[model samples]
Target: MPRAEFDKPVKVLIVASPYYKDISDNQIAGAVAELDAVGAGHDIVHVPGALEIPTAIGIAERLSNFDGYVALGCVIRGETTHYDTVCNDSSRALQLLGLQGLCIGNGILTVENYAQAAVRADPKDQNKGGGAAAAALHLIALTRKWGNSGQSVGFASDILLAGGKTTA
Candidate 1:
């Protein structure tokens, strides 16, 4: 993935659901690696399940000084509809938070089985957790480019370049 360059120092919060211990651990590892690469400070918060990640992030956003957030978890499809509810509700809440101006990178895996989650969660393979962290970093860079209001006010859009450089 392309890199997001920060003009200012950043701190990130990682809200993770470790329902699947091994899978969630790998995801967290990938997310941490990405944050470390960008020299961002990060801390992990464990929740009971995927459903709680968004709420944890929301609370952090309100009370903490994090510049960005990475959400990591796994929701594998089982014999019941519980999987769908967990997947949809968690995702929708995260999206709502994003729409409200939070820089969140969602890494929740909604897979059909353990195998799929394993493949995607593996930092050496799909590295989805890393990808999600990158997404949040990009948004952070973009947010800084436009200033804290997060609404582009100029008549013309700024052509963003690497490392948060932009030309109007």
Candidate 2:
């Protein structure tokens, strides 16, 4: 994995869903550990479910100064088709936000069962939460690499009149 180096401490916002408290807790632990390893500061916000994670992050992006964002949640299959909707929609929203140039790491787990979710959420196991944090860090590094290069170009016009030269 590529590690991002920072001269100053980076601040990240973690938007998590506690629908499955145990899984969410584990994910948060892993994410926190990873951020601490890289000397980055992080703040966490809890929403009701996976679907709300993106909206919370979007609000933060518009109102706060976080360097990056980590989204953590879990959606296990149920009797109905709600699982698919939650998983797909949440993931899609995060992707769209990323495309808009917000550095975000999606750690939302979509699994067939609780067992599957457990393994992925476990810090001692797959540790996907940590991976998400790393992803955000890498993106932050990339953004910094292209620092301040998003400026819009201005058009300048020079006009020569009969009496004298005029510039607009």
Candidate 3:
């Protein structure tokens, strides 16, 4: 069994969006494989759709012991604005968690149509879940480093150092 030894072992919650069960399943499977590669401890939870991801995330955050989170979902665009709402809201929520050093990896997909969704939903060609898991690992590393830093660093400062720059 692969195992990772962290300065502080983190409990992670994988909140999967159940909107598109098939896609979500693929996402979860990939996420699990990635997590297994890192040998990190994790639990899986299911939500109705992308909209509910944040609520689940909030629960994980409040647990106060988890080192990070991974959000997995698929939202194929429809004729309505529903797609926009779910995608934006879910992304923002994860960003908020990241800002708080919650170390969340998001694998939610906003596709133009079912065909495109299907393409990215493939476990082989589309490994967004794995990408998200890797992101979580990096975030965990960053958080551990910043927490131990003697110098006080703000959230924006951390983001900037993490190779993120604001475009204005």
Candidate 4:
């Protein structure tokens, strides 16, 4: 995978839910390794479950100086529809945050059983946690690229060219 390069120092916040201790640990290890490889600074925070990962990240974005976030957790399917709810809602919340321009990497795993989660969470295997961290870093790099500019871009510039025409 192509890793994002940075000009300035980057800092990331890792929000991990250790509901499944074994899986969560491996995921965190992968995430940390990826961040370290790029010399990105990071801090880790734990939540009780996957559902809370987004909320914790939101809080950090609002109050902390983090450049990005990595969300890590595992949700194994069972007899109840609760698995669907947790997986969908947590993912949706992260997406919403991302839409709002928050640099976030969602590493949450929604799988059929322990075996599936194990494979994906393994640092030496799928390394999805590392993938998620990379996603966040790329977003942070993009943010730095665009946010440093002094002028507006895309549609706004087009509107100005059109003599202040309003889309609405």
List clash counts for every candidate, in order: 0, 0, 0, 0
Superposed by TM-score, candidate 2 places the C-alpha of residue 28 at a distance from the truth, in angstroms, of: 0.4
Encode model 1's per-residue lDDT on 65-129: one tens digit a residue: 99889999999999999999999999999999999999999999999999999999999999989
Query: Top model by TM-score, which number?
Result: 4
Model 2 misplacement above 4 A: 148-168
Task: TM-score winner between 1 and 2, please give it.
Answer: 2
**Candidate order (TM-score):** 4, 2, 1, 3
Q: For residues 42-136, what per-residue lDDT tens digits would candidate 4 score against the true structure?
A: 99999999999999999998898999999999999999999999999999999999999999999999999999999999999999999999999
Candidate order (lDDT): 4, 2, 1, 3
Clashing pairs in 1: none
Per-candidate TM-score against the hidden true structure:
0.87, 0.88, 0.80, 0.89
The better candidate by lDDT, 1 or 3, is 1
Which residue pairs in candidate 3 have backbone atoms (N, alpha carbon, C) closer than 3 angstroms, thus clashing? none
Error of 4 at 167 (Å): 23
* Per-residue accuracy of model 3 over 80-109 as CA lDDT, tens digit each: 998788889889988887786678888888
Estimate the lDDT of model 3.
Answer: 0.78
